[model samples]
Target: MNNLDLQKLLDEMTLEEKIDQLLQLAPAFFEGANSAGQITGPLEGLDLAVENVRRTGSVLGVGGAEEAIHIQEAYLRHNRLNIPLLMMADVVHGYRTIFPVPLAMGSSWDVELVRQAAAIAAKEAAVAGIHVTFSPMADLTRDPRWGRVMESTGEDPWLNGQFARAFVRGYQGEGIANEPYKIAACIKHFAAYGAAEGGRDYNTVDMSEWMRREFYMPSYRAALEEGCEMVMTSFNTVDGIPATGNRRLMRELLRKEWGFDGVLISDWGAVKEMIAHGVAEDEKECALKAIEAGVDIEMMSSCYPHHLQELIASGAVDVQLVNEAVMRILQLKHKLGLFENPHRYADSVAEREILLNEQHLAAAHEAALKSSVLLKNERNVLPLAKDAKVALIGPFATSDDLLGPWSCMGKREEAVTLAAGMLGVADPNTVTAIGCGVEHIPDEELAAMVEAANSAEVVVLALGEDSEMSGEAGCRANIQLPDRQLELVKRVRALGKPLVAVLFNGRPLDLHGVLDEADAVLEAWYPGTRGGAAIAELLYGEANPSGRLTMSFPHSVGQVSVYYNAFNTGRPKDDPNAQVRYVSQYLDIPNEPMLPFGYGLSYSSFRYGEAALSSPLIRAEEKLLLTVTVTNVGERAGSETVQLYVRDIAGETVRPMRELKAFRKIMLEAGETKEIEFEINEPMLRYHHADLSYKSDPGKFEAMVGPNSKEVQALSFELV
Candidate 1:
């Protein structure tokens, strides 16, 4: 149906029908009994309420190909208007063939891999009859402490935008409106949810309009430009107004100013939670505020279905606003071809054929390998000889704990463990011992593992947070390895063997112990099902690790808000005496992060040469060419991520000390030299001024090129 047809349908619907269109019912798979034995509302069974809602108009959240077809049949049989139900699922990473989380994928700096991951996710999700996926969360999160940061691409807006476009193209392949199996991509958390106060999930976001426009809004815009069909509103309040009810953000800016024609869905229960935000007195008021703010769908929030009509009748919201929202929802269904053929995606044959296909597994393996960053390889202790008697220590050594959280579809039993993969590459006599669990293990077990390590030629200790330690509702009180696990590492190190620490985590860990003790450290951040295979490849010199740190690793949780791009304080903590005054520096630890963003090591070494600009001065319409030489100094072939960072130097408002402008991941043979160049246009140099205009100031600028934030070669340029 065209927009005119959707608008005509909306015009003819009753208030009840319009309200029904706005509500999204939960899937039967999510409604069931809790561990407490009490019936915990629909997280897993087909409820009578779901059937009633389907009978009224249309429903959402029907799962699997067969069940989706059944729901479509019911909607056709029972709905008075014969409107088709839309099925939505949270296909965050992969549907069944799991890939590394978004943050890990971002470290690869490979757009094609990112696209392929989303494409596989869409294929599996579509096979299950899902017409829409709420994914490609484009939030620019700098703080690793935020549990949801793992869900985002990374800290830089440009990189996030690149991945956002790739994901949108991948999910809505060849346009969602035309493809039978393609699902609509819902670019999420509309604005600045990543800047939540203190990195706490769902906390209020307080940022200047300048910051919001320059850094936060770019990813959303990129997703829209890439043809995303829907957007999910964030749960947190921005400038004291809940996103679900913020008319200035949702209506005035997003819709009117940016011309976003796609549907806007609220995050789960966000509309009802407006009462908790102290913005709405009741669900009725919440419905009114959200509808007026231009939210098209209320996900898992009963407020719209129960109270929208009452609010509309009271003149608290206009009928036109209701019609507009309903029209957008119907348009999305039309785009999904739901109105014409409701059962188009409900193919049982495709469902069984697509999930965990060989191609998907291969892609997952490639992603896992690319995301595994070789953080430290002191004296080249890694690439352990295939014939060496290696001792695989730590609980995760044999456990499938590398598969991180929000992995609803991944089977731990199917994942390859480090010990299994290592044994595949090493001699049959290779020793394996469980040194310590990520969380709990007896002291005697640790001692026995350490003794085995002493008998081996080399020891590989796999350490990291448990699978449940990061993701939604998995916030940590401390961002370090569990003290017991660290103690186990200390004991293993005392064995006097060549030690390699493989970290399996969802976020950057405080690796002070690994840095000081381990001979080699590989940051395998929750490498998916093929995690073990990837680790083995990196270990045996089959693949060179090239992934970089997308987020900073803080020295301590006390330095919680640390990032490469931070506003300089009037009293900078540059001097030891200034640190004594207790300005921004912690007394016990320095303000710097343990590992800066864009920091990663390889099996081989790299040296960054001096940076040069093509032109020292340029006009608004012109561009600057930045060139730098990167040489592979080590004896082995490897890849290096050459990063380009820029400082505003002077602006109308204070700016971050440095911002990532461009990055290129280059593969070089031993002793090879590569000249990496970046074209810096207005967008690269632009920042939000006090007036909220994204403009580049005509002043002196500093362009730096290097391996990471701290190590760089700088050159000054004048923008005239």
Candidate 2:
């Protein structure tokens, strides 16, 4: 219904009825079987709640396709209002044909693949009778210690924004109002939840507005710009205010500043948690605070239904605010065509037909291939020669640990193991050994695998954390390979064979020993469902590895705050003579990361020529074009990621030594050369001034072009 019609209906309802319309409760019937098993039905019980919603005009959660159809039919039969219930599900990753976690997808830097994965996920979810998916997490994480990092695209704002738009487009697809088997995409953890202190989940975020705007807000903006249907508030407090009750953030910034018109849902039980945050005195206060803050839905909170009416009746909240919230919910339902055909999405045959289709599997394979970062390939030791007798050793070599966390929709039985993939590509005589269980195994099993390694010409040792080690509630005290796994690798290396180590992980790990011992290393990450096939293709020269690291790999877990973009210390430790002084450098290790952000190696090497600027000086309104020529110097065909970075030599405030501005991934045959250019505009140069204005100061700037942050070709430019 339009606003006029909705308001006309509201005029005929009592204040109690109007307040009830703003509240939503999950149906008790078929509650436990919902995706993730976190959903629960209403207070009075399933049947009672259904009857109550029928009379009260509230929403209920329908379990799946069959249940959704039954509930809709029952509501139509019993209700005078005939209001439809909203079916929701946690469709994280793929609904049935699972894809890689968002972090792995971000590493791919392939936006289209990410879109296809989400599109398939939405297709399966919609077929299952889900109206909305809590997905496309746009949180910008810099801390690997945060377990939720698995759910987010890695730390870059620009890359996160691109992925955000792709996911929103994929889920909502053209428009949810018209498209069949499409669900609304909820862009979540609203703002800066990724900046959780100490990398702990649900920790406080303390950052300046400048940092929030520059590093965290872009993805949310992008999601909104792409017409995301809903937004979920984060659990963390921002600047000492819980995000669930922050009126300035939700009302002023999100709705007013950015013009987000979508339904704003609080994170799971976040509305009630406001009491724990000390922002509310009780459930009544929590309801008043959240609704007044512009939140439209309370996911599993129950505070909205229990306390909102009392709060509104007592004049704690305006009646119009309650009406506005109800209007938003009804508008979404109207757009979904729920009133006309509530059971439109309730088809069991479609559910069986759409989930895990062949096209979805192909997309997952392409995503895995693109997301595999070739961290090191010394002596061109990859694309293992055909018919070569290779030894596959490691706990992960035969294990189904390839499916990373948040892949509940993925089945382990169907997952292809590294051993299986390699055997499929290699000759019949390919040797294999399980050096250690990816998680846990007996010492005897480790010894046997190491013995088998002695007979092979080359060994491929897959290592790193299992699927459960790097997701939500999976925070680690030490970000390194388990001691047992490391020891196993050492024993396997004693066999005197060239070894290639493949890492299957969610976050960056401290792998200094493997770096030194292995002839080559590939940070495959948790490559998702077709991970094995993708790794095998890259290993046997069927595919070229082009992915770059989105996060820095620390030398040790102690280097917790490590990143490529960090402000230079006042006492810079550049000199060898100053190494002993207590400065930014660690006594035992270098300040540099084990592998800098954007660092990756290919079978072929690329040589970067000197960089050139179109103009030596640029005015406030003018832009400059920075160009450089990169040549493939090695003998094999490969791809190189050309990165453009900028440094402000002088600024009103201190600046990071380098910041990534633009990057391009280029493919080249042996001896091929290409000239790549990046445009530097006013926005690229702008930063928050001391007075809080966003502007570029008239000063000297350095433009650097290179393969990664640590190695770069530099040129000077002036912005006036």
Candidate 3:
């Protein structure tokens, strides 16, 4: 619909209808809604009649094309204005052919692969009649205690921003002007929801404006820049005010300043829950504040319908706020071409054809292969010989729960198991197995399992958090492997056999307990649908491991929030000539992360040549060319991600020790040397200053080019 038609429809809406349009609900609100995606029963109170639901502009947490059609037909049947209900869902990773969780995808360090995965998710979700997906969660987090880290693409703002843009472009493929399989992307939890105090879910966040802009807001900016059509308000407070009701954040900064006119949504029940947050006295005030703050849609609650009309009558609120919100909602609907055809995406034939199609499944398989990071490989025990007898032991050995949390559309039964994958590559008879469980087993049972591993030439010990133990509401104080799993590692170590530990988890786990025992460790974070096949291939040298860590794996839970790019403290962790007492060192453990960000190993070794610079000095306007030669030293073809890092030697404000500025992923054959060059420009050096201005500080700067953050060669340059 055009602007004229949208305005006419908005003008025609009654106060009650307008308020209802702002409300989003599940299928239970509709009379004949299916149970496929229903999170809860119909919410009680104000207006949930079938007619009210018909006018309710949007529905979420409902599954399938036929069900969406059922609900949309019901809504359109009773409508005088013929407005269709907008369908939305959290297609977080995949709709059917689930790829690895976003965290694992981030590990791949391949933006194009991430985009392709999102495109696949969009295609599958679009066929199911979903108009919007709340995905590419751009929350910058550090603490592993945040269970939702599985949803985020890890801790770096720069990396997250890159992934955020890729996801937006993939989901909104050439905009709404395109066909099915492309939908609007929603960059969620608007500001610093990940930096919740102590990393607890839904906890408060107290961030300084400088810290907020410097570290947390970049990914959101990247999303909006990529044309993300919606923004979801976070549950946490920014400064003292909850982001859902903070005008300065939602309106002044997001809408006016950043120029985002897209629809703004509240995380499920975030609006009314603001009362519990002590920011509002009641639901009325919560609704008033959220609407005034420019939240166009109240998801999963009755706040607006419960109080908007009364507030309008009592002169506590203006109806214009409601109209503007509704207009934004209508714009989304129009852009989606919903006005032209509400049932466009609801096609059962297309849904049958697209879900888990061969190409999508293959992409998922490749993604899983690249996402498995080789955390530790001692004595070169990895890249198992094709003829080697394999014993795959673990509770996950045959289980298909590889589909991690947030995989709503993916059926676990369809997931390929490790046992199945091993059988697919080689003879099933050559692969022995035992019950490898995350939880504890009886001593006798454990002994029997160990006996099975003893017969194989090499053992593949599958372990890590249960699927339910590492997602939303799945926070763990102890991120180490479970007690039984830890004990199993020790037992396997006593056998003095070559072993590989395949970890299926969401967050960066503290691997200290089991690290020393395992000969090789692969962080295969909840590697979705094709997880089994990918791991099997990596083991047999079919695919070389190339994925890197996006989030730093802490040496211990005590160091929960660890990352490569950290501010230089007043004192360093260890001064070679000084006593340890004065420095910011941890007495018990080293201050360094166990596995630093951008750290990964491939089967083939890579050697980085000292970086060569075009010039040591350069004007602000002119660019400096930084070049480095990366050679594959090992006797195999492989992929390497060459990272570019920078440090502000001196600046107007404090700076991180090293910041990732750019990276390039390239493939090389044995003994092949490739030259990689990156343009160093003024924009790359800019940051949010003490006064909130974004600009580059003219000063001496250092750049490093290498395989990862920790291992690099540096060169100095001047930006004058």
Query: What are the lDDT scores of the predictions, listed in order?
Result: 0.81, 0.79, 0.87
Task: Locate the minimum summed-lDDT window of 10 residues in model 3.
Answer: 38-47
Tens-digit per-residue lDDT, 45-126, candidate 3: 5455666677787888667888888888878888778888888888988998999999999999999999999999998888
Sort every candidate by lDDT, greatest first: 3, 1, 2
The residue-by-residue lDDT of candidate 2 on 29-126, one tens digit each, is 33323423434322331123433355444333444577667656765676455566666666777877778778888887777878888888888877
Which has the greatest TM-score?
3
Give one digit per residue, the lDDT tens place, for model 1 in 1-720.
Answer: 788788777777777878777877664422221111111132332132644565343334454677777666756776678788777777778877788888899888888899889888888878877788888899988777788888888888877999999999889888987665678898989889988887788888988777788888899899998989889899888778999999999999999998998889888778888998999998888888898889988876677777777777787778888788878778777877878888766688888888887888899999999998887888789888888888888868888876676664677887878887777776767656564567887878887887788888998888888877888766776888888778977987887789999888887777887878999999888888888988888888888888988888888877777788888887788855675585765678888988888888888888887778998887788989999888899899988888888998889999888888888889989899989999888767877777877677889888888998889888888888
TM for candidate 2 is 0.93
Give model 1 RMSD, 1 decimal: 3.0
RMSD for each of the candidates? 3.0, 3.0, 1.4
Error of 1 at 390 (Å): 1.3
* Model 3 root-mean-square deviation: 1.4
Candidate that would win on lDDT: 3
Error of 1 at 649 (Å): 1.3
Name the runs in model 3 displaced over 4 angstroms.
36-47
| Local error of candidate 2 at residue 143 (angstroms) | 0.9
By TM-score, the better pick of 1 and 3 is 3
List pairs with backbone clashes in candidate 2.
Answer: 27-41, 383-539, 395-436
Global local distance difference test of model 1:
0.81
What's the TM for model 1?
A: 0.94
**Candidate 2: count of backbone clashes, pairs at least 3 residues apart or interchain:** 3
